[model samples]
Target: MTTQTPAVRLRGITKSFGSNLVVEPLDLEIGRNEFFSILGPSGCGKTTLMRMITGFETPTGGSVELDGKTVDRVSTRERDLNMLFQSYALFPHLSVYENVAFELRVRKTAKAELDTRVREALALVRMEEFAARKPAELSGGQRQRVALARAVVGRPAVVLLDEPLGALDQKLRKEMQFELKRLQREVGITFIYVTHDQEEALTMSDRIAVMSRGRVLQVASPIEIYDAPTSRFVAGFIGSCNLIDAVVESGRVVVPGLGAVPATLPDGTADGARVVVAVRPERMTLSDQPIEGGFAGVIAERVFLGDEWTYHVKAGETELTVRVPSGETSTALAGLPEGGRVWAAWPAAAGRVLPADETASPLIGSPA
Candidate 1:
């Protein structure tokens, strides 16, 4: 039996600028047709990693492979990959059709094939009607589509997008997120997306690699990444999580102000081990009435989000944030104003325990 090669592979890849270590040694494999995201804050080396894969920068160690072929010394043009940027680098004077056709022209493709490919690429991005329009005449979203058409017109083996949607407004960015995913599926090619937006990564990625200080911390599906973050940084960075410092005793986590809460100890964790209990804000429930084994607090503040309201409850020294859905629904905590007293409750399975020391914590992965 033969094994299929991954679409892209990085083995022991490391990069440094002079004496400054930009990326730590890392190994990663992206499967065929996968929408993989490298997420992190600025200066976390995600863009540098993308550049390494594009042959724009050479790695200090190890190799980059496309379909199992090492391409450490390959020129950018020779490698089977295409890159799309945030600025949508389209020629100001060229029509969208010519922009998409420029790549094929350079390759000396047959005229018939070039015309067909350009039109097909334009059609794929739903921009065929604007083929004759110059880049200067198009809207930002339209320009983005034109650039996307140009990127995939040559049908490269992999596409590397470096914060491609960063320039768009929030509404347009959200729209393009779905569009980007749809286009990737239709093209059936590997997509390595680099972004610093957490919501953007969560919305579109098949798997996310969360990076911090040049190291990949964790790589997993979006659901798993959100629900099962392995480190304190991952827990705090991925979403709005309540990371309560606590100590484990008798199979429960004892928070400084919130008292004890049920938690499933990770393997090898002792009774007196210091840990942090991570719970998503939305997982916590607030009741106007006191309940058994629940923490009591007064609302510190209330922020009204369109679809939901976030209630910040102050219980002793610990403050817990709860997300309550909007509308006059029975479950909604509508009349609970700031300074209102309430009790917070969550099932035992809601909290995930992690080691207290961040350095003792493990790696995590991602773009935003």
Candidate 2:
């Protein structure tokens, strides 16, 4: 755990299965004590990359360095790492304390030192009182804590988690999100978490590496990843974004169906080349009166969300959703009903333009 070099580094790493490439040559540097996550959809090779880091899978090309030393030839067991599977993988017969202490016993640590470490690990996850309970008798969250305790008890240099919260219910999963973050800070160990859940990645990690098609798309903090996705794939996959097809005319983006809207374009974008503008629902506002720099639409439907009222509006053939504060719904809509004319507006900073195609469809059905 003590090192000046990165905890893990993958330089020009590539892996293939026969003719199909699972992971393209990619370079990544993970800092010491950094809670990093590798996120992507199924078949995107997130798991394969994590396996290579833990020494469970060999790279067909390139190499993996741990603490500045190449460990591509090392065995999984010999690496100073611990991995918690999606399945808790706890021993049913062993008590939580025994499960946490099992690793110490394997290395023949002293009895006094083993007990002290086990208790500390259990307390770190707030599961010290349930130390005597077996995995079968504990709740999902409790069992998850036990698994975490077991992984951290041996003080591994890095802990790899493969969707540890995927097994829990929605409420329990949300609760465990904070719990895991707290545990990471308390133990001060580097955590490399892999998951396809976007919300989970945004909620827990210090930084996220968004991947697709076996390549890393963008690596940044949660805010940057969501606000400034490097490509169309990252924008659409990370969260809910209203992607409108547009084209760059001069320097501004001219959306065909919705007219020209201010947007940021990448360098060397052709004047008539097709592009897309991504706008989040939360960034939009609905009103009856004309506002500065806002698009006009017709109200098509309305839904009541707990703290806000969502109005689906049609801008030509495209439909957009706008969320207004619960208290301002009546004033905002001004008695507008289905088919009533209105305006959906937001600042220039709210939208980002990118390369677009048929994939940028509206969440709400477009007006006929």
| Maximum-TM-score candidate | 1
Runs with alpha carbons beyond 4 Å of true place in candidate 1 = 327-333, 359-368
In model 2, which regions exceed 4 Å deviation?
Answer: 1-3, 266-268, 332-335, 357-368
- Model 2 global lDDT (CA atoms, 0 to 1): 0.85
lDDT of 1 by residue, 1-368 (tens): 97779999999999999999999999999999999999999999999999999999999998999999999989999999999999998988888899999999999999999999999999999998998999988899999999999999999999999999989999999999999999999999899999999999999999999998998988999998899888877888898999888997876679886779856667666788888888998988878889787899999998989998888889899888888777631443567678888888777778888777752453122122
TM-scores across all candidates?
A: 0.95, 0.93
Whole-model lDDT per candidate: 0.88, 0.85
* Per-residue accuracy of model 2 over 169-275 as CA lDDT, tens digit each: 99999999999899999899999999999999999999999888788877899998888765678888988778787777887788777777866566566678777
Give Cα distance to truth, residue 226, candidate 2, Å: 1.2
